[model samples]
Target: MKIVKRILKIVIALIGLLLLTGIITLWLDSSGTNYLKINKNESQFGNSYLIKNVNIIPMNQDTVLVDKMVYIKEGIIKKIADTIEVNGIQIFNGEDKYLTPGLIDMHVHVWDRYELGLYLSNGVTAVRNLWGMPMHLRIKEDAMADNIFSPAFFTTGPKLTGSEFVGDDNLNLSNPSEAKEKVILYKDRGYDFIKTYYGLDKEIFDAVIEQAKISEIDIVAHPSQKVAFSYHLNPQIKSIEHAEEIVQQPLQFDLDVIKLQPIIDSISQSKHTRYSTTITVFNNIYQMMMDDSILDSESLEFMNPLILKVDSENQFNRWFNAKQEDSTTVSRIKKQHDFHITIVKKLHEAGVTIVCGTDAGIGVTLPGFSIHKELAFYKEAGLSNYEILKTATINASQTHSMMSQLGTVEEGKIANLLLVDENPLVTLSTLKNPICVFVKGRKLNRETLDSFNEKAKNRKNLMASTLRYLENLAIGK
Candidate 1:
């Protein structure tokens, strides 16, 4: 009896220790001091500035307005004209430079706050994080309050899935009531949207959608394998996540472009439907798993050390071992990836709205860098440079329902703009580096942005790394 009592005490003590550790970790992760907080000074925040003699790609059209001056005051674009004589305004000589709306990555998995600077440095001014945790709410609040030098942030609640869940960030619903209850909980918690995963059943999916409508929130979904694809194509879903979801449908192969006309038409006609093409992410994984030389070239400097460790132990290990045992499986994945690219082209041609999204922070898709690669994939899929840019700018803002305030550089819009050395419409490569980025009217030059990137690359300490590794393990990542 005494032995059993002692064991029970030990178990209770261990549980208490774990609970305390988790609370401390969450506090640290959400603290403003741990992130690159933008000092809210008069010069950087809520200040008036003018960029003189610049070319503007407003992103509302395919044309550029040349030799114009843009005036920003109090985090808003106050005016744009050929010339503006404004007193007490800092002036930037934008001679031969081009200004465009900041890029947005519509789908990302944000694991840590450090990646926020990485995203901003890559010209991504806004992001829609697909997975949400308690820490994310704090991050969102900080971003919205302009306390952090981060992107315009939005996030969905934890992913809703059925059985076969792989991580702790998912709510596994076995019935309609559970789904409805979870939706209400997340809505009350202030999550922006509801993210549905692949294992959900038709009944549970319908319940989630209905509950979300009642809660006045949006639904972002990956078509469930258990449900028919047509079910997910309803106008209720805000965005369809991956291209594979559409490509995996049973369609007769034909050379005629009209073969996919019906599917495309349905998607185009839907009131609340946008597609996020995460092609670069899948392609990155395929290259790393199939080609040894390619894997060696892919750098891990910018990736979170904890993510890398978890991936190396789980996803990477599985792929590498499988490739060594059977090359045929990897070949099949490559073929599937090519098919996904083809489908993306067809969707673009059919006038379906495409939003740029890189499934970054998962495997090898580094946070900020993957969006640029996604744009390149869109180009390879036969989209013009202008069209590809739209997926990241205008279309992305539209997806997030922030078109009025974002997606374009005009008077009365938020001052999330990027100034590049060359014309991005003519050459997409110019967007890979920005001369300066203005977030909410605060200017960060290339040198300052580079410092942010460098800090993230070398920010991992031994204690944090170990804690993160253990956290990922506990969550089954």
Candidate 2:
């Protein structure tokens, strides 16, 4: 009996030692700056630049303002004219290049601060993050003040869900009272909005909406199929995510215009709620369905390696395993994707507001790059380049009520602009590769942008991610 007790103590001590070692490793990993914030001071922080003879595709209108000299000072577009000689500012020879308003990605899942530079490199100057924690509020405050490497950060609190709680990151509210409490908690915590997710039922969903209204915070929903889709169309429910969600829930796999048109009409008539186009993400699912080999996309290099490693067992593995399913599923996914495009077309025709949202940082939908792919899909939906740009710029800003300061290239606005070689209004692909991007007047030219992508592909941060996950869990974020 004495020997048995001694053995148990020895075994427990070994486990404790191993745990301590693991925690130390994570702390060291989080301290390392291998991947996150690689561009901390790479670019000189300057809010002034002169672009000579550039064509401006100011998003407020479709036409390009040709051969204009634009002046930016203190991070604001100071003036624009046919020619202006600035005494002190550095001049960019933008002859024949197209300058436009920086893009806004309304729906993104930003994991690390490193991802902020990725967005800027792609001419995405502002992002509205769908998932948020306490860490995110800090990121937002930092980015908002004077972070050249980061985008203008707007984030919702950690998603609220129902008891089933499919996602680990979400706050699962077991009852209506708990749902109401969390709404206040998130608002008080300084989250920009409250996001409710799929598992939520009618009672809890209503409580959330009611509480959000009382808290004076907006509600963005990934609607619960358990509740009628129409239940989420209230004015307080600001935006509904994912076109596939609509097809699955309210449409119920029915492509019939009779059913679809009514939903579109109701949303348009109300003129309050908006839809985010995550069609690229759904199309990515179809691509994964068609080819298992696609799991090894070179572009995945830009994503956080730690996320890629875990997703290998989680999201990546699920999709890769799904390739074994028969061809019928693939065809069905293709059909659903087509319907999503159709839904967008009908909604646009009905004058319903649509914002561009790539469910980036999930599956193989790479951030920064995915927005262009989403625009390509919108092109397939018969939207013109100007109209498609609206989804990314004008509409996105309008949805967030930031049109005064953003979403257009105008004198006196913040100098968040994109300069591309070819005209974006003529060929949207030019946006895929920007010559330079100005994020709050901090310019990152192409060479510096390439460095951001390269660091992401080469670095790994497993221990850092584990530490973050633990923190997020402990904080109920």
Candidate 3:
């Protein structure tokens, strides 16, 4: 009995010590955190503004409205007129710059506040976060309240990974009843959608889809390995992620070009379903495989320290240190990167909706900057610049039913706009550095945007974010 009592005391003391450490870590993380407050710009135009003599690309169509005036009131675009007069609100001289609706990255994995600015700095005004946590909901709430300078944030619940525990971003549920319950719980918790992952078996996948349909929520398909590719072509599935996933899951990593056409035909027939091109994911793999020193590149400094810490298995180190050349190389990984480009081009020709996305949070797809490269690949795939912009703008907005509120620069719409120095239609490179971006009504000008980018480069709040990430794992429970 004495020995038992002594052991119990030791366990209690260890628990207490751990709790104290967590408190200290959170305190340090919140210390000197002035960078989170991003609305430091001198705004004579407080959520209401007038722009004179701007060329509007609108993005509802391929035409441009030259030398127009736009009036915004309380974060809504009141009117876009050839000439307009307004008083009591600030007026910005457009000076003939090209103004368009803000870009929408249809698929992303956002882990921290820093990544929010990365998207905005790159002119991405809205994002659909794929693997979500309770922390994401808090971030969305804060962003809406203007407490955090962020894009229009929407997220799914934790990924429904049945029978497999992959990483920190997973909630494994093999039971069908449990899967249905999670759908309801996520909906009640205010998650915008439910995300399906690779590990889910057919039984669990069916339950999730049925529950999502009954609950009237949306489903975003990431391809389930246990099920065939055609299984994800359900009417309830809104968007399919990653062109490479088509190879990974549906094609089952088969490299036969002969077998590819039939699957492409089936996808082409699913007219209502939208697809996101995250070729950057495979491109990252190819680069890591080929380049000896790419893992230590300077671009990775901007990655969230929490993500860098949590993926402790270290995908970069694994790829770099692999005994074989590079696992993703075509000789080993099957279909070549050029073949992936061909797949994208075929999808475009089939009149499929191709949305712009970069799986930016992981491995070397730099958040703000990498979208341009994805667009360049689309260019190589034979999409005109207008069609490429549409993937990130109007086409993207339609996927989430946000077109009523955003997706265009027209009357009676929320003001999410990006102003750039050059015509994006002529040169897609102009989107890489937007002169200014309007999030809802708040404006982030060049200098303010630069500051946000700089802060994002510095890794902050490592321990605190990791603890929060752990806590978020049990959100549905």
Candidate 4:
């Protein structure tokens, strides 16, 4: 018995040593320049070049071909088309490549640390996170401070949902006063906006909107019967997400249409608020409910084969199967899809402010890949290529209030841009193959971004394995 006890003690000590070592390693890695943060001053990795003579796809204005050299000095576009005398400026021949503003994915769940690098690899220079955890807020701060090499971030920290909203962990404000208090708290916390999830009651929603408006914070609401079109177009909520939620099915016009139409017209023209229709989510959920062959047919070309590998893995399959079989109550996701497109078409016809967005990193719309899928859905909704591109590029920037700096490539705009191998005006899919991404003049090519992701992937795996080992030790297995 004494010998056995001693052996057990030794085993426990060894386990403790291993755990301590792993934790220390993880911490060191986190603090390192190559991990969560990037060393911005390091010039050994970047190109010291003038990309001259590339066709520019200025999203807001006309495409131009003024032969000019773009100079990169310390990761910023220092000059455009300037013929100043500079020595040792390596030149990248961009005679064939096309330059446009860097893509902004307005909606993403980059809560997972690796997700940001993945987005960067896909040429997404900025992301407007609808829901952000505390960790996400920290990472955003780091990125903004230039400590982290990540896309520019804007967020509504966590989310405001009602108790009835399913399968989400968000701030549930039950009463009108509670809603008001929470909105004030969020505004004080420096959130870019208030992201409303499903199930907010009329009273609570109204209080939130009133409080948010007072706080000078915008509200991005998910439309429903509780917070439907009439409520949205009015003073409280401004924009609706997931098109169907805004105006799906028939509603009795018991309210004055005379009063409503003018209000709607005004909202359509207003720049203060806009819609981010994450139609990709609707299509994903809709295909699962009905036919999925359409999804396979269209998405096969754009979606990364790696994503399919992940989905096919037994772990994800089991999770997906369990959710699909559970039928306590399913959303009118199909009706919502049909209704949403119809309404969006109507909005476009009426010249309403429509911005393109995809709820990427959701269940199926994997990050980096979902942007293209979203544009496809927009096209299916009858928007032309130019219109669809506008939503993803120009409209997204306008929605996030960064139109002047980041939306389009112009003389005075911040040099957040993309150089693609093909003209995106002819094919939106060309955006998926970004040759280079420039954020505030700091450029990163596919190779550099991919290297970052590779490191992150290894770290994620190592962390997972360490946790599993610790779990086994806890159970004495």
For model 2, what is the alpha-carbon lDDT of residue 108?
Answer: 92
The whole-model lDDT of each prediction reads 0.81, 0.81, 0.82, 0.65
lDDT of 4 by residue, 336-399 (tens): 5655565566667667767766877554566666777777777777887777777767777776
Q: Model 1: clashing residue pairs?
A: none
TM-score, predicted candidate 1 vs. hidden true structure: 0.89
TM-score of each: 0.89, 0.90, 0.92, 0.75
Candidates arranged by TM-score, highest first: 3, 2, 1, 4
Winning candidate number (TM-score): 3
Better of 2 and 4 by lDDT: 2
| Model 4 vs truth, CA RMSD | 6.9
Task: Give a tens-digit lDDT track for model 3, residues 389-413.
Answer: 9898888888877445878888987
Poorest 10 consecutive residues by lDDT, candidate 3: 326-335
User: What is the alpha-carbon lDDT for the whole of candidate 2?
Assistant: 0.81
What lDDT is reached at residue 47 by model 1? Answer: 46
Error at 295, model 3, angstroms: 3.1
